[model samples]
Target: MTGTMQLAAEGASDHRGLIIGLFGAFVVATLAITVWAGRQNKDADDYYAGGRSFTGFQNGLAISGDYMSAASFLGIAGAIALYGYDGFLYSIGFLVAWLVALLLVAEPLRNSGRFTMADVLAYRMRQRPVRTAAGTSTIVVSIFYLLAQMVGAGTLVALLLGIDGEAGRRWVVVGVGIVMVLYVTVGGMKGTTWVQMIKAVLLIAGTLLITVLVLNKFGWNISALLGAAAESSGKGTAYLEPGLKYGISDLSKLDFISLAVALVLGTAGLPHILVRFYTVPTAKAARKSVNWAIGIIGAFYLMTIALGFGAAALVGPDRIIASNAAGNTAAPLLAEAVGGGPGSTGGAILLAVISAVAFATILAVVAGLTLASSASFAHDLWANVIRKGKASEKEEVLTAKIAAIAIGAVSIVLGIFADKLNTAALVALAFAVAASANLPTILYSLFWKRFTTSGALWSIYGGLASSVLLVVFSPVLSGSETALFPDSDFAFFPLSNPGLVSIPLGFLLGWLGTVVSKEKADPAKFAEMEVRSLTGAGAH
Candidate 1:
C-alpha cells in the first residue's frame, strides 16, 4: 500500500514536470514575439488596432482566442466531469450569446466606434461623462476578468509544476503580464491578432483530438458513453434528461444557473471582444468576423460535451476528487488515463501539449483585456478628455503602456486576495457587471433616439451600483466566514447570480432616464447617430 501510494505521487509529479516544461516553452515564444512587435509600435493607432489592417478571417480567429479564457478551457471541462449534463448548459449559453452579438450588436458598434466602446457612446453625447463612465466600466470589468485569469494561471502552474502556491502564481502572473504588455505595446493589434489565431487553432485542434480519442475508447457510442457517465455521476436520469432536474436546491443546480447567465450575456459585453471589432477594416468585415467566430465557438463547445463525459466515466470521481480537490483537473487526468500512465510517451506528450495550450490561451486573453482597459484609460479618458485631445501619439502610447502595467499589478494583488474563489464564478461576476453597466448604454445610445445623456449617465451608475452590490452579497462572496461580511455568511438572495435580475434593470433604468429627460435631448444629433450607426454613412 505504501509503495502504491508512493508510485501514484511520483507519477503525478512527473506529469507535472512534463506539463510545466511545455508551458514554459510557449511562454518564452510568446514573450519574444511580443517584444519584437513592441519595437514596431510607432503610433496610437498601431498600438490599438494593428493599424486596422486585419481581414475578417484573421479577426475572427483572434475573437475566438479572446473568447476562450480559463473558464472555457478549465472550468467547463471540470464542471462536466463533476455534474454530467448540467455542464452542457454553459456551452449552450455561450453559443447563444454570439447570436445576440452577430444579429444585433456587431456591425453597428463597428460602424459607430473607433477605438473604444466609449467612443461610440460619446460620438453624440457629452464626451466627458460618457468617456469617464465607459472608462470606469472597462477598468472594473477588465480587472475582474484579469483577477480570475491570474488566479487560474497561478493554480494551474502550481498544479502542473509542483511548485509552492505563491511562487507558482506570481511567476505565472508576471510572465503573462510581460507577454501581454509586449504584445500590445510593440506588435499592437497585428501581433495580438496573430497570437490569438495561432492559440485558437491549437485549442480547437487539441480539444478535437481528445474528443475523438475519448469517443473511440467508448466504442464510438455516444448514448452508451452518456449512460455510463449518468450512472457513475449519481445524478440518475436527470443527468441525461434536460430540465428534468428543475427546481432542485442542490449545489449542482445553483452552480448551473450561475454559469449559464454569466457565459451567455458576458460574451456579448466584454471590453476585449468589443475592441476586436475595431481591428476589422469595415463594418461588413466586422459582421463577417462575428459569423466566423460563432461557427468556431459552436464547434468548440460541442467538443466540450465529449471531453467532460469522458473525464467523468474513465477517470472516476474518487480519483478525481482525491487528485484535483476541486475536480477541475479531471480532464488532464483523464487524458493520461486514456493515453496510458503519465510516464508513457503518449500520455506525457498530450499532457504537455494541453498545458502549453492552456498557458497560451490565458496569455492571449489577458493581453487583449489589458490593452482594452489601458486604451480606455489612456486614450479615451486621459488623452481625449483630460488632455483635451492635445497629447502627441507618443505620449498617448506611453500612457497606455503605463496604465497596462498598473492594471496588471492591481490584478496580481486581487488574484492573491481571491485565491480560494472559483475562476468560473469570478469571471461570471465580471460578465454580469459588463452586461449590466456597459451593454445597456451602448445599445440604447446607438438605437434609441429618446436616449438622453442623463439617461445614459443614470443607466451606467444604476447598473454599475446594482451589479456590484449583488456580487458583494452573492453566495460565493458572502459564503466565506473571512470575507467582507464575516458576521453574515449567507447571501440575502439564495441565487449567487445577478444577471437574471440586474441586466433587465439596466435597460429599464436607461429607458426611464431617457423618457424623463426627453425635453433636454438633442433631436438632430440623435438622427445623425442613427445614420452613422445604421447606414455605414461615416465609416472609413
Candidate 2:
C-alpha cells in the first residue's frame, strides 16, 4: 500500500475510538427521540400518522431525510467518480420524479388515504380483494427498498471498522436490522419522522460542507475542478460525456433507459413516500410539504456535482475502487482527502462525522420502510381483509409491531446476500418494482371511474410478478461479472432493469382487466371518492 493508503487503514483503526463514539452517540440520541415519541402514541392515528400534526416545513425536512438514503450520499458519488456523467444521471431521475408526485398524486393521495395506500383503492371497490392486493404490493416494494438501504449500511460499517471481508458487512447488516426494528416497533411514525428530520438536516449540512471544501480546493473555479476530474478519470472528455457508462452497447443503452423510466415513475408509487403525505393535516399542507421537499432535494442534488466530481479529482477512481469495488465509500474517502491527507487529524474527524451521518441515513430510511410495510400488513391485510374490520385499534398496532420484527429478519437475510451490489442500482430495481406494481393501481384508482376490484388485483399482482420475474432472470441477478451471484449463470433477460417492459405492461394490464370485468361500477361510490379525494372532505 502507498503512504496515504497505509495511513488510511491506520487512521481508520487509530480513530476506532472516535468512530465508535460517534456511532454510539447517534444511536443513543435517536433512541431517546424514539422513546420520547412513543409516549405520544395514544391512538391509531398517532401511531400511524403522528396525529397529522407536523407542519409543512417539518414534514418536508423529514421527507428529505427519508428520501435521501445512502444511495444519494454514497452510491451516487461513487457512480460519478467512476462512471462520470452517467452516474450523475441518477440524481436527475430522482429529482424530476418529485414533479410527478407533486402535480399528479400528492394532493389526492393525501386526501384519499387514511393510513395506507389501500385506503384509496378500497374506497370504490370490493374491500377485501383490493385491500389484500394493495397490502401485498406495499410490503414487496418496501422490502426491495429496505434491502438496498441495508446493503449500503453494511458496506459503510465494514469500511469504517477497517474490516476486510463480507463477514463484517454481514454483521453490520444484522445490527442495522435490529436497530431499525426497534425504531419502528417502539417509536412508530412519530419516532421515525423525528429521526428523519434530524438526518435530513445532517445530510444537507454534510453535503454542503463537502461541496464548499471541494470548491475551495480548486480556488473556487468550477472549470478547473471539471478539467481535473476529466483528466484524472483516465478517459479524457469521455468522462464528462453521456456514453462513458451506459453508451457501450445497445443492450446497455436499453438498460439505462429502463433505469431512467423506473426512477421517474417510482417515487409516486413508493409506499413509504405515499404514506408520508398522510402525516400532514390537509391537502394544502401536503402540497406545501411537497413544495418544500422539491426545493431542499433539488439543492442537495445540485451539490452532488461537487461531491461526485470532487471525489474523481481528489480521491482518484482507482483509489476509490480499491476502497470498495462498488465505490460505496467514495463520499467518505473524499471527505478524508479534503479534510487533509489520510493520517491528518482533520481527515479523521471529517471522515468519522460523515460516516456517522451516512449511517444515520441508513437507519432513518430503513425505519420508514419498516413502518410503511408493517402498517400495510396490519391495517390493510390483517385488520380489514382477515378480520373484516373487526380488529381493535390496539390489536392492529400490535400486529404492526410484530410485522416490523418479521420484516426486519427477512431484510437481514437478503441484505447479507446482496452486500456486493451497488446501492444506487439496487435502489433502481426497487423503483422499477414500485413503478410496475403500484403506480398503475394508484393512478387508476384515483382517476378511472370504471376501474373494478378485479382490475386492481390483476394490475398489482401482474405488474409485481412480471417485474420480479424479469429481475430474477436478468443479468443483475446472475450471468455477469457484477451479478449478485456471479458464479451462477441462468440469466436470459437482455436488460438489467425491467422497467422498460414491466411499466408499460402494468398500465396495459390494468386497462384490459377493467374492460373485461363483469362487475359493474357504482357511480355513487365513485362520486363520493372523487369529492373526498379532490377536496379532503371527511378524511381522517
Candidate 3:
C-alpha cells in the first residue's frame, strides 16, 4: 500500500508538469499573436474591429471560440455528466440561440454598428442617453460573463495542478485576469480574434479527439456507450431521462423554462459575440460568419454529449462528484481514464492537453468580454458621452486599454469572491441579463418603428435592474446547500433564473414607455436606419 501510494503521487507530479508545460506553450503562442497584432493595429478601427480584415470563415471560428467559453465546454459537459439527459437540454437551447443571432441580428447589426453595440443602438436615438444605456447593459452583461470565466479559470487551474485551498485559487484567478487584460490591451480586437481562432481549432480538435477515443473504447457503438453511462450513473436507466437536474416541482419547471428562455435569446445580445459581427468587412460577410459559426458551434455542442456521457460511463459519477460536486473535472478525468488511466504517460499527456485547451477557452472568452466592455467604455462613454464625440481615434484606443485593465481588476476581485459558485449558474445569470436587458432594447431599436429613446432606456434599465434584483433574491444565491450563499436562505424569489419574468417585462416596458412618452417618433432617422440596415446603403 505504501509503494502504491508513492507511485500515485509520482504520477500526479508528472501530470502537473505536463499540464503546466502545455499551458505555457499556449500562452507563448497567444502572446506572440498579440504582439503581432499590436504592431499591425494602426488606429481605432484596427483596435476595435481588426480593421475589418477577417474573412467570414475566420470570423466564424473566432465567434465560435468567443461563444464556446469554459462554461459551454466544461460546465455543460460536466452538467450532462452529473445530471444525465437534463443537462443536454442546455446544449439544445444554446445551439438554437444562434438561429436568433443568424436570422434576426447578424446582417442588420453588421450593417449599422461600427465599434460597439451601442453604435447601432444609438444611431437613431438620443446619442448620449442611448449610448449610456447600451454601455451600461454591455458592461453589466460582460462583467457577469467575465466573472464566470475567471472563476472557471481558477477552478480549472486548481483541478489541473492539483492545488488546494482558496489561496491557490485566488492566485490563479488573478493570473488569468492579468493575462486577459494583456490580451485586450496589447492585441485589441485584431490580436484577440486571432487568439480565439487558434483556440477554437484547438478546442474542437481536443473534443473530437476525446470523443473518438471514447467511442473506440465502446467499439464505436453510441448505444452501448449510453447504456453503460446510464448503468454507471447510479440512477440506472433513469439517468437517460430528463428531470434529474430540473423539473422536480412547479418552481423547478419554471426555473428550467427560464433557463431555456435566457439561452435562446441571450446569445443574440451578448456584447462579446455581437462584436464579432463588426470584425468582418460587410453585412454579407457577417451573415456568412454567423452561418459558419452555427455549423461549428452546433457540431461542438453535439460532441459535448458524447464527452459528457463518456465521462459518466468510464469515469463514473462517484469519481466525478468526489473531484468537484459540480462535475467541472469530468472532461479531464474522462481524458485521463480513456487515455490509459492517470498512471500512464498517454493519460497524463491527454489530460494536460485538454486542460490547456480549457484554459485557452477561458482566456479567449475573457479577452473578448474585456474587449467588448472596454469598447463600450471608450466608444460610447468616453468618446461620445464625456467628450461629446470629439475624442481622437488614438485617445479612444488608449482609453479602451485603460478600461480593459480596470475591468480586469474588478473581474479578478469578483472571480475570487465567486469561485465557489457553480459555473453554469453564473453563466446562466449573465445570459438572463443579456436576454432581458440587451435583447429587448436591440430588437425594438432594429425592428420596431415606434421604438423611442425613452423606450430603449426603459427596456435597458428595467431589464437590467430586474435581472440583478431577482438573481440576488433567487434560490441560486441562497435557500439551498448548493447556493452561493448557502449559510442563509434569503431567497424571496423562488426561481433560479429570472428570464421568464424579466424578458417579458423588458419588452413590455419598451412598448409601454414608447406609447406613453410625449416624445414624438423620429420618422426620418428610422427610415434612414432601416434603409442602411436592409440594403447596407451608406453603411461604414
- What is the Cα-based lDDT of residue 174 in candidate 2? 95
Q: State in Å the error of residue 381, model 1.
A: 1.7
Specify the highest-TM-score model's number: 2
lDDT of 3 by residue, 77-150 (tens): 88899889998888899899999999999999998888888998888899999999999899999999998898
Q: Which pairs of residues have clashing backbones in candidate 3?
A: none
TM-score of each: 0.92, 0.98, 0.97
Ranking by TM-score: 2, 3, 1
The candidate 2 region of ten consecutive residues with least summed lDDT is: 1-10
Model 1 / residue 214 / CA error / Å:
0.7
Q: How much lDDT does each candidate structure score?
A: 0.77, 0.92, 0.89
Q: Candidate 1 has what TM-score?
A: 0.92
Per-residue lDDT tens digits for candidate 1, residues 355-414, read 677778888888888889998999888888899889898888889878888888788777
Candidate 2: lDDT over CA atoms?
Answer: 0.92
* RMSD value for candidate 3: 2.1
Lowest lDDT sum, 10 consecutive residues, model 1, at 1-10
Error of 3 at 17 (Å): 3.0
